[model samples]
Target: MSDIAAEFDFSMRSHGIALEMQQSNYLNNRICRPLVSAQATLVLESANADLLWDQLRRVAYVPGCSKRLAGTNWPDPQVVADELSAFISQAEVYYRAGEETSGPSAALQYYYSLLNLAKAELLLWRPDAIINQKLTHGVSAVHATGNFEDWRVKPQRGGVFPLLYEKRMGVPSSHLPGEINPDQLFSRCLESGMEYIQVRGKTLQAVPLYQTIVTDGTYSWSHLLIEGYGVIQQNKPSWDLVREIFEELPPLHHGNPWQVFALSSRLSLDSFALLIPCDGKYVRSGDGIHIGNLRLPEWEEELAARLRPMLGHPHGYFDGTLTVSLSDSEFVGLTSDLARYLSVYLVSSLIRYRPSALDLRLNPDQAWYLAAFTRQAALPALQSAANEILDNEFVFLDRVRG
Candidate 1:
């Protein structure tokens, strides 16, 4: 875990420079001063992680910026204390919801616990850094709020909306990408979804994070979803894949077919396009679909079918027993497992973390933004940090496959 923290620290330093967070020599001096000294201080204090994470669930709007842990010269420690208080206060809504899921947003309830935990960990370390606007934008902003795991929503592609979802009861769709058109598969899955989105970027790493979900002016439920196809392929996740899965969903009956949401991602600009390609000829406004993707039968089915069976070995992958059992506890374990994977991937991308390399200047505001900005820029290294923990397990899985 210390290794993970150290790597993330380096990642932020490298990224902070790249993003111009340390543009001034004064800022550079301030930011670089803390690295080695703060390492141990930052890593050992792990208490009530969930209590803090619960705050992010309250976020309603996309933030304009983000924070990272890159700066050396610590800003007002007093401000950090105040933000910590706010982070805890806001997270309470989700904590209370977790204790009782009576609201219409059961999906949100499920994610509330995990989102809080993530924030709590970060806030415990740097309260003020989480809110730095220069560090990130939109959904990234939401996560720092300590309100919801805003990281879960599929990234919007260039100002588009996507259909995000809650788990619904439906057989998994079997005829997805391997045989079916990937676009059609996505469309069919979201047919009955409540949240639709349009996006800009192309691909994203599949790691659960806080997401803000709203349509028009009304609030919609925010929950976790897969971000990268690579993650799905790697995990071989089980989801509903039944055809006509959307038939059971009730229409929103309020917003237009083009209602915009708060946490939706722009089209994927990354090398990987995590979502279906936008329909050009059918496209009028370059709209996004925000319908729920989590429980949509089409999505489950398509993903299931698209990810071919782990074959070439034996029928043991699916024996005649015909019964599958997975506990909430198991999923919790999976969530942790997946998070570590993503963190490691992010961490590995960091090559170096010196202020001189950053090549930027920082003012007060810029210093705060450095917290999240550099950390995100260093995601690949953090992701690698997470993966380092899994090397053994992956080898074991490969042996099983063999």
Candidate 2:
């Protein structure tokens, strides 16, 4: 939802009830009732939310899903993931350094990374998963960004010299997870678009827009600031072709069709976590903490700057939940929290109602044609459909491609 929801609609999202929509009465009495009922259910054959919680903990970060640990040792999924990712990452750093083509933990991070992708794969098949499937890793895009690889090449003794250190096996990680085949990714993205468009109430023959990965990562998306938004497939967005029309692009549109804020391996081996800067460049925020351009208000910029000093979060964007720990109330009160959360609701809804048109078998060429048309002005019907919900209207920010 970070930047992704900005592209679509969000007013329809809800978790039965979101934090922003919380009711005090429900929070106090209603919350405990579900716990009691779940616990009581365990009394018969199997109603152990605690046990569920335990096993789930082995994998998941959330609680109350099981019985055995329901009331005793409550651990936040957010915090647990944060801690586990860090613990595993630390174990990985040491293990990657010490161990080799031997046992487990060496590839634990690798497997964990793929495990995430596997989960995404499960979600992808679901009618609502945004990406039809997590783009399967094709060839390595390690050289694409030039930010990862050779993470820590420890020297090893070798050769004629008794104590001359030769470099050990280097780590191979990319600044972005673009090992994804674009042909497949763009195609599936359009499929998602078609379905999304239809959900807003539209039935056009097709939509053609230069699908861009303005920002892609494990937990964030910001396609709102994309230049190739209105691209047609036959006239695809290549760096060369884009150079010609780059001048004509809107302020929000970054030059290329794709602009990933991939997390570099300087952080971890999983992959570059992403943060699409609407502007082509990611501005430095000083110190070891680097951030790209976010469309936050000036006041928030000042706020983030002030908080940055007080908050010792090196992995602010990367390994949060562990560092800069926060209480449930504190996390709930965050501005970006609800927006980040809406993705969950969106995915669940997508799964429940597998809408047609979101089919992955979309034609990029045809989709681009629609993009060209919409660039001029919204087709009367398409515009109507996009705003069908009335209260939820598209916010194109500026006119004249400025």
Candidate 3:
């Protein structure tokens, strides 16, 4: 019944088609040869079986209704815009470097990147297609994590870059044939979030990161960490301060109102992924697919040692008898700065993936930790970046004050 209901739901979602649900026993009683006909609805034997009828009757098939639902986890348009710009810049640089084969390869990559950008734009216009849309640029996904070697090939599962590249290089690509109109696609992308500028009386697009790059001889997010460390040391933020900071930060308004994870006693340094909690359940989240567990970096031992004193340790946090929470013990010794940065970064990442109120035994100090990070590092950096990303008249602080 659930499987049938889910299929019906998908049909309604994608094609705006509706399915009528009728009781199985009703068919069995009405039809002379009921055994020959398979039932669309399941038959349950119980005193409370009438309740199931109520559920079936209430299954509403409203076209495009989900669009009105708040907190849909749509990918940030700004990230896509910035990355496409970065790729274009890299391509231009490579093409001009006078390298024999490197120039053509970069040019080809840029071409593919533009097509992917168009596809992303199409998704924005047809929001219903977002769930089914596969990522077009694998490289962009790899770039975000900063762990290139591990994530480089991963995006290929949902992206076309690798197969297309291989085919272009005479590697014999075995894929479906789907061509696009470049002019129309580019126009659509412009309608989405792709920005441009005028160069020598000609319109040119693909200037990276809101057209204002911050070159600090480090990764763009590096300052968040550096500032987080420095600010944590200089300021003694109280819980009250933390609460105020939380209220200021944007709320998670997407799918999955709640995520519950019961911890286990098992612990290991070899694994960067969170341990599977026996009683773990993702409530209200769609599908809840565990995508091979999220990869978190192993913090420096010195930093972890610095954070050990302030952390709490409670036994039985996990299902088994344990001295402390598995994550807490594993995450022990983080420097206050690193901890602060991680808390904020992790929260943002979680919210981006599927915004939810987390109910987990691991690292319960995340709330206060996030508060401190927001007060010290997040707000300041966000404000500065917002000033650059937005026009002079619409700075983040001005909006916040308003």
The best candidate by TM-score is 1
- Candidate 1 backbone overlaps, count: 134
**TM, every model:** 0.22, 0.17, 0.16
Per-residue lDDT, model 1, residue 130, is: 54
Q: Where does candidate 2 stray beyond 4 Å?
A: 1-87, 94-182, 185-225, 229-402
Query: Number of clashing residue pairs in every model?
Result: 134, 27, 8
Each model's RMSD to truth, in Å? 26.4, 26.2, 27.9
lDDT of 1 by residue, 1-106 (tens): 1221122222122111223222232121111011011111212222232422322322212231113222212466445444544544444564455345431222
Stretches > 4 Å off in candidate 3: 1-345, 351-362, 375-378, 390-402
Across 209-313, the per-residue lDDT of candidate 2 in tens digits comes to: 111122111111222122122322223322223233223334222221121212222422121111222233232233312222222222223323433211111
Model 1 per-residue lDDT at 236: 21
What TM value does model 2 have? 0.17
What is the Cα root-mean-square deviation between model 3 and the actual structure?
A: 27.9
Better of 1 and 3 by TM-score: 1
lDDT of each: 0.22, 0.23, 0.22
Measured with C-alpha atoms, the lDDT of residue 287 in candidate 1 is 25
- What does the lDDT come to for candidate 1? 0.22
